[model samples]
Target chain A: MLALAWANLTHHKLRTTLSALAVGLGLALFLVSNGLATGSIGEVADRMESVQAELLVLPAQENMVFSGGAVFTPGWTDHLASVADEQGPLATDVIPAYWSQITMGGQQQRLFGIDPEQMPLFLGDRGMVAGHAFEQATAFSQRIRELRATADGQPLDTLLDDDEWSAGLELVIDDRLRRVGQDGHPYEIGDVVRVLGREFRIVGVVESGVAGRVFAPIETLRLINDGGRQRSTMFFIKLRPGLDHLVAARLFTEQLGSTVQVQPTSDYGRRLQQELGKVFMYVNVTNTLALIVCFLFILLTMYTFVLERTREIGILKSLGVTRRGLIGLSMLEALLISSAGAVIGIALSFVAQAIIAMRLPLLTVELPPQHLATAVAIGLVGGIGSALYPGWRAARLEPAVALGYE
Target chain B: MISVRNVQHNYRHNGVVESVLHGVNLAVAEGEFVVLMGPSGCGKTTLLNILGLMMSPTSADSVALAGTETLGLSDSARTRLRRETLGFVFQRFNLLPTMSVRSNVALPLRIRGQHADGAVDKMLDRVGLLPQAGKKPGRLSIGQQQRVALARALIGRPAVLFADEPTGNLDSASAGAVLSLLREFHRDWGQTILLITHNEHLVGAGDRVLTMRDGRLHD
Candidate 1:
């Protein structure tokens, strides 16, 4: 029986190969699409949790970690700092930051305005890979103050020389951004990157997966974006070593009223998934449809194959091969094809991952084991399931009638 | 051994009943070689099908094969009976073209959950096809393919061998060769043979000959 099934498949090589490839392509699409969705969300959550802060304070409506805009004031940070001084154990440090979408080197990306002096403390043990961490940011802030005092409120870019402007707004980018520079080249230290409509030289490259891809000094950004009103969109807070962040978050929420949202950084991944539940649902629905299409394709292919072998089936039946035996043979063929398709799908997923990594460096693509298992299961089960009707039809065929079939 | 008494069969198509076999009665003892001679559409194949347990007659008093009453047996039971007691050769030589000659001959043993145990090679040697065992049925000549089919049918050592115009598509020499093999198997193993044919010249090879016409049989 096994020999006969194998022979039948090999007898029509092109059809079998095409059928398997169709199934393989469907599984690969499901895997890679789901991988991208989960991978992008996971990447953002991981980077947010790596910011060295136990908690973040944002405007009440802002639950997503990467949403960038000037939504509140730096006065909130001063208030948090005041509380840290008073409570002693409830809080230790508060760092103000501004986040916004800005174009750099003709690509839109997230930019975080972090305090030059406190950025290192907030990033505890996360060292830079190239140059220094905002070494001239303090001096640049002082220069901005002096220029504001003397220039009668002239635009900052006009008041300074090109080199002075570059020095005043130094940029620090993550290593991922460095891989994709203007004109298909990689960025390096001392290269000027245009951000927020101003040229700022890249001073340092930090390890990826911490905060936004691009960063600048808070003082300069606040003065430019907030008109020196000392506004900040969020504040990162460090806690005493043994404190429960959930309790701290509840306390912050109680004190800040309905205008602020506080959450522990560690819970960001789960929270982000909840916040983007609809996106994930859409992805799952789309992938399931792809699986169904693959199932239907196998069904049609196997059905046609069985039809073509009517006379052969009749011969087997006449030779006393039971209906059960015939059905088993058909299902066995389906299993073999599906198993081959699953292997092809897995290989194709890796190829897809590599392509995505090369073309879009910042977009992480994860091939989790469970997704692979699910894809293979779908292929196998679907193949068997799709063969059921065709096999049954073949089994139910009358030997005399089938033998007479042209 | 085969027996039939008052067996009848009909096929209905588009509200019209076409009777193919009517009250057919026949008996062939164990080891007897019987030839059923008939014109086309004269119910010879239908009677063979009923005797082979491949079809259930619309009406029958008794239709027994190998001492078992087969008229009302379940499909699986009939299938087991067919596998255990009978073999068939068809006019088209109905060899599975996808399989090599040896594999085709080994099919019955495989279906019966028995290993070939050199039976396939032995049968191929008997059929003078040992050199062609590895070749697919499609690559063989018509006569060779029929010979392979004959080997497949006889390899299981069935009690009854049913040949439905086994040499219908063969040349005279090929037909003579297949008929000789059938005679040899019957003489050596005492295999009960029911061969159907329209060729009157082959009637001499059978121990008894029955003619069927218009769904009725005559001795």
Candidate 2:
């Protein structure tokens, strides 16, 4: 019976191939779109968790974490350091950081301004991929603060009594920026980048996707905000290695009062992932529609095939083939076609991943074996289910009328 | 053996009733070779259809096959009876075009849940189609296709073989060859055959010949 079904399908080569192609196309679209959705969301979650700090000092206002993130003053960095745990300090180290969007060479890039002395504490030696780390001098930071407080840039000479203070404006760019400045102009370690009318030379380029693509001194970011602003967006609290962040988060929230928000790192990752999930609803809808279109394509193809084979069905009936046998043959035919199509779709998905890598570099797609199995299973169910009606029609053919059909 | 009495069939077209067969009676003894001949629009094909159980009569006084009453059998019962007792060769040969010649011959046995067990090869060999067993019916000539149909009909060793103008679409040489093969089978196997044709030259090959007209058979 299976042999007969196969022969019949192969006999009508063009029709069978067209139907299989329709099924393959549907499965391929379904796989590629879903993979893209999951991959893009996973990338965002990865980048967010890459931050060095395990504790965030957000604003006390609830839901403000996603509203351009919660902002607080750089003064909070001092308070966090002043607190104590059973160990020497409540937190191992503290960094006052500000994230601001700045256009470099006509493209927006994330600029993280951290205290230069603690760049190793945040990013370690990997942060200094090229050139050298910032020189460890307390006066260099104090000089930038004094210069930023004054209304005019001329106060910088008076504030910086030491000639070496001029070197404090050095920048360490992320490797992502070193490549092409996040799809903008390429930059070397010694290149100069101007942000908000101030020039800072790149002293180092860090690995991509680990830290911010652009890094400057905290006082420099404060100056970019406006003279005498003196405020930072948030305070980053780095916990001791192997220390529980949850315990430190609770300690900080209790000691800092309810006016400040302290959140563990894991919760932030979850919340951001939830945001990405909300954005993926549209892709899910498209995947559903694509599968439906695939189902309809197969259904129409099988129906027309049965119509064309009506006379053959009648002949089989006259040859003493039972209705169940006839129906079984049709279903077997459809299943074989569907199974072959799903395999092709699986192969196509691999090509889709490569295409995504080559064309949409920012988006990553992971086509796990389980995902491929799911696509194949759906194709089987869709293709076989679509043929049931046609099988019934073929089985129900009247031998008397059909034998007479031209 | 086959028997039918007062069997009538009707067709309703455009709200008008047309009687195609009226109270037709037929009986062919076991192993008897019978030929039925008639002009177009006669009830010869209808009678053959009833004997083969491919069509149910609107009403029948009595219908029995192999001494068993088959008149009121259910549809599945009728299909099983056809599978068990009857084999047919139609005007167009009716071979599945996509199937190999041997597969076509083995189909009925497969449907009966019985392994063909070399019966297909034996029948094909008898029909001189052994070399072409693996070829599809479409690859064969019309006469070759009809012989494959003939081999397929007799492969199950059915009790009765019904040939309804089996060579109607063939050239004269092929028709004569088919009739000769039919004669050889009857002579060697004492196989019962009911052949229907409008060709008078084919009538003499049967042990008994009859003509049908106006919904009735004449001796």
All DockQ scores:
0.71, 0.55
TM-score of each: 0.88, 0.82
Please give the range of 10 consecutive residues that has the lowest summed lDDT in model 2 chain A.
Answer: A156-165
lDDT of 1 by residue, B104-143 (tens): 9999999999999688998899989999999999899999
DockQ of 1: 0.71
Q: What does fnat come to for each candidate?
A: 0.66, 0.47
CA lDDT, candidate 2, residue B213: 90
DockQ of 2: 0.55
lDDT of each residue in B1-219, candidate 2, tens digit only = 988999998888999999988898888899999999998779787778777777778889988887778888876677788888888999988888787888899998988888986888888999989999999888999999999999888887788899999888899988888888888888887778999999888878899998899888888
Listed per candidate, the RMSD to the true structure in angstroms reads 3.4, 4.8
**Model 2 segments beyond 4 Å from truth?**
A9-13, A60-66, A95-97, A101-146, A149-222, A226-236, A257-263, A267-269, A276-280, A305-307, A402-406, B5-23, B39-51, B55-64, B67-75, B210-219
The most accurate candidate by DockQ is: 1
Tens digits of per-residue lDDT for model 1 on A293-383? 7677667766776777788888888889899998898888888888888899899999999999887788787899999999999888888
Query: Model 1's lDDT to the true fold?
Result: 0.84
Mind giving the per-residue lDDT tens digits that candidate 2 earns over A97-174? 777777863566667767777677557435466876554333567766655666374644345433543465667776
